[model samples]
Target: MNSRLQHLLEQWSNDQFTEADKQELIEMLRSASAEREIIPVLQDMWEKTEDEGLFSEEHQQTIIKNILDRYPAGELPDKKEIVPTMYAIHRTHFIRRWRWAVASSVALIIGIGAYYWYQHMQGKRPVDMVQSTTRVQPGQNGALLTLSNGSQVLLDTLQNGRIVLQGGVVARIRNGILLYEGTGSEVQYNTISTPKGRQFQLQLSDGTNVWLNAESSIRYPVTFAGNERLVRIIGEVFLEVAQNPSIPFRVDVNGSTWLEVLGTSFNVNAYENEGAIRTTLQEGSLRVVGDRFNGHLQKVLSPGQQALTTKGNADIRVFDDVNAASVTAWKDGVFDFNNVPLEEAMRQLARWYDIEVVYQQPVPKVQLGGTIKRSLPFADVLYFLGKVGLHYKLEGNRRLIVLP
Candidate 1:
């Protein structure tokens, strides 16, 4: 065993390891031979400590299966080679001393090792050998605000203060939140649009809270003046409509779909590339209407129900028992991939990273299942995807070419 690896292991066993030491230990264990040696040590440590019931046997098996199933048939490493790595990756994290943090670090090591091992089996250059000159950071809180007078303000760069719009309507930005104050009778409209790699939060004049996802926009009146409060949105938005039984709130999505909210919380995904508009109701009831090219369709959704409207189709499909948390995970700073298709996952990445994805070959038929933090760097995100047998190459700073 390497002296440094031994010292790190001692620190970890004694619960004295710093984060950097833990990371270094993970990197060192990337060697297959080292993995074999570390497995026994991890098992011994686990055996000495009483099981804390952190992860059940069924859950552990499921996680192991999820990782192993990423490889194609007959291409997987030998069972002897894989079992030890899996044990090391899965069991070490369960040590009562460093449960969650150690799990993340160990899982990353396994992902990196699997990616390199697959590349070796295919006679391709390892990931480290690839030339990547650019580092893309995660998206930030920012958007472009279009005033009623056709003037635009870059919210990311603007100072936090009160801004008087047309007719003396005041908008304030404090701690990165846009809040509208006072009331107006003229019903002037303002639009907040988030470009790729950006998101923003806004409190409408009616006290409704709106969260704009990447490449999304919401246009609404400066204040609620009439009996009906109406807004138009593009891309995706999660809204918590303020309760007002007298006035109904309506959302016009890209001029194709309409959502009526009677004080409900829901999310709308209407990206053109997605081929369908998905509205997942989180709380309260929502009425969704789809205006297709041929006909019109509508559906009333209950809480936890999702309505899907295909573009150019006249039918509105409602799915029951939908995962509302997974649907609005982005708003909560997570990328939920539970049963998400590969193309859809890539689209999320493209939007958040502000990069274009091009397929050099046929798109891989894969379903990803996991949750990753949206705060991770672009490179780390790609590394996590490698656990699913996905390969890619970054060209220049903005293009991600998917490999077969």
Candidate 2:
């Protein structure tokens, strides 16, 4: 299909198509037989969209009306009995604005030569891929909570409403967010942790909001009664600190890195397996400090900056130009692997899907860039790696062996 026409179709499929655009699309669909054949594939893709909720029931009915108007009968897919082949789309100008089509950086489709594919006797294969009968589903809102007395509670299984009361604070789980009500003079500590393939959000007594990524944990007090509001975290977290000039907000990350702020929004990724702690600041100013041999190494970061502290090295480095969107993309449920090494990218996948990654040979020197919806099937994620000449296979149920 021509590029402009494809843009129009994408807009129409996203429910953002204008009346004028819809008229144009209908005329094109009626004029071209090849274009008309794509309607079935479009419908299938839309049905699998991660954001299908965006299309209300009424909007879906409208889309059906438009398709039936063109076909006159509900024989669109019947005419083309073949299932559409999937492909990986690069960051082309034509598809830059169509990220909504798929959940990830790359989208799957019927026609695209940019992706690698193999022809099979049965049908067309996008890649030499295999599917496990038991697919590992994506993670959801789940975590384990540990109270001051060491009592444990599974947050996911607990029903909403008041779940805990201690240290003059009442805790509740409302719509999947753990919330604390009422401030307290007496401080009681609590910890929340997300196991592999799970994530959760929390609202502190001070009104600060925190989102914990998979395989992550955070420890905080039930209320902010100290001179400074402090929390300790391991793994990854996106925090929006409530503004309190009287009490500066402090984050103790992995016991080595520290973040001090009056009130700001920032993300800290201190996954020990990642070999470094990265702090990306999005709003307001904050100081990132690393424990050094001499004393301390610190860098004050403004908005749009990132600080990195390598493992076994106390030296801190500041990056003025940071990809804030990509850094905190995890909180938004999208993996933005823009210029990320293959190893690093796989580490993220391993954590989210709770799969083991083993390189059968030397790792390929490949850097990938794209946005992928985290909700995509694990098989689809592997299909994307095939585009860069990297191949993988599932061993048993949870092991992924990457081959060059």
Candidate 1 residues lying further than 4 Å off, grouped into runs, are: 1-133, 292-296
Q: Please, what is the TM-score per model?
A: 0.72, 0.71
Q: Alpha carbon lDDT of residue 246, candidate 1? A: 94
lDDT of 1 by residue, 299-356 (tens): 8999999998876665789999999999999998888999898999999989998989
| Candidate number with greatest TM-score | 1
Model 2 misplacement above 4 A: 1-133, 292-296
Q: Tell how far residue 332 is off in model 1, in angstroms.
A: 1.0
lDDT of 2 at 39: 47
Worst 10 residues of 1 by lDDT: 67-76
The alpha-carbon lDDT assigned to residue 76 of candidate 2 equals: 21
